[model samples]
Target: MATDHQQCPVAVIGAGVMGTAIATTVLGSGLPVVLLDVGQAELDRAERTIEIQLRHARMMDALPSGRAPGRLVTTTSSSALAGARAVVEAVVEHEATKVGVLTDVAGIVDADTPLISNTSGIPIDTLADPLPRPQQLIGTHFMNPAYLIDLVEVIRGRRTDEATVTAVTELLAALNRRAVVVRDSPGFVTSRLLHPMLNDAARLVDEDVATAEDVDRLMVGCLGHRTGPLRTADLIGLDNLVDSLAALYERTGEQRYRPCEQLLAKVHDGHLGQKSGRGFYDYREALS
Candidate 1:
């Protein structure tokens, strides 16, 4: 028999790509969702993004036919988080901002309801430190395009209990995503491996080794990578890349993780990748 939790909505904060994808994946798995954001316009845009992705999934026969489309609710009010079975925070990467959002969400959801962080590289322990239920908070770093990606890095914080980790792992399995359990670290695993390559790629561009397009092509043709490091950084947002690099460098004091001059210049110019219509490539005409 299905318990009442079968009907309880999962609450997702931050309405960005990661949050919306998280909500979309949960809905595809047949769970209701309450997605919260601070701005009405942002929530409206998130709804449109979700609808487009869901329609595309259905067209491709990727979405389960039995899944309900109208199961998601969007709100600007934090009060909507009440009675949520689990909460995932996917806000922009900033320590102070994330800490504040997590603390706020922790107060609304039930003590036992799992709280998850979708941060790419922020230390899970730092975010969990201030929460009332530190043991209940765990890191579930879902990759970009959350609905399509199956790999989720599950980071166990110093204070995170065994039960929380197991519960989150089971939840990932239910969503059809695989979990790679790892101990809390500066960049966990993926970011540490990926970001340095991206930084080196940017340095190549800075030193005029090759055009961004050519560099991306070499990785695709020679390296057999589906997407090159430069393009991936653009998709991830250059501003976000800077933040991630700074966090990694600060935590480990590693010079390789330092944001390169090219990246810094692009961010300074407000060319924040696809979102800003320009970064390594110009999407101005296409995005408009």
Candidate 2:
């Protein structure tokens, strides 16, 4: 049953940027959150990153001033999620790795506890296959810098139950995000529309048609885009963008959705955008 004030002990697995953002956002929602990552080091880094994000969010008025979310608990043990009512997996974009995480967390959490994926483009149908309770599988696509972005796409898998979708949508609304219910399709709505633009920007830079600066200037100035596609890709992370595009193109056979060579090369060189302090434009340590 969907409740207005469901103060669940939410378990967020993964300590990367998105994972920490999920944990921090849930904590800010006044629900107890258990953050489980790969190991002690990752958890420690996650802790630091979240603290930085919260402070930044405060500066941006995204989070309340003079008050911080007090409902966060950190752990390296998967057992920490044993009694959790919901587990949100905010891990890497590999199917095999994510499946393993879903399987292990499902084993630890309560049977009725909903397992959600914070995936950008992974299809929930494939994820559901590895789980015993297929009806419980759902996707919550949080835009990068989760605490800031107000959009959370609630994607329903083929076998997903209506109740679970309603529950998660309500949960996201409680977190103060605008929840958009998207059907289970390759790239869903946001990525399907946004990725091609980003790829185009990458191609422009790759072909030396325009400098990165000019491209961004042209996009924001002439086109009136909030943030240019190339810059947005940097913020989203090239590797993640690549994975999403690859998944979309592979599943739907759309050539335009194919990831660009420059983008793939940047990912291989470890130029993972702002998070890594470099991408198209160099980030000089987390936006001052």
* lDDT of every predicted structure (CA atoms): 0.85, 0.83
Candidate 1 Cα outliers beyond 4 Å, as residue runs: 1-4, 59-61
Q: Estimate each model's TM-score.
A: 0.94, 0.93
TM-score of model number 1: 0.94
lDDT of 1 at 273: 86
Tell me the spans in candidate 2 whose CA falls farther than 4 Å from its real position. Answer: 1-5, 64-68, 285-288
Model 1: residue 183 alpha-carbon error in angstroms: 0.9
Query: How much does candidate 2 score in TM-score?
Result: 0.93
Best-matching candidate per TM-score: 1
lDDT of 2 by residue, 54-152 (tens): 777777888644455857788988888876767899888888899999998877666567789888777899888989888888998898778888888
**How far is 16's C-alpha from truth in model 1 (Å)?**
1.7
Best by lDDT: 1
How would you encode candidate 1's per-residue C-alpha lDDT over 181-249 as one tens digit per residue? Answer: 999888899999999999999999999999999999999999997888898998888998999999999
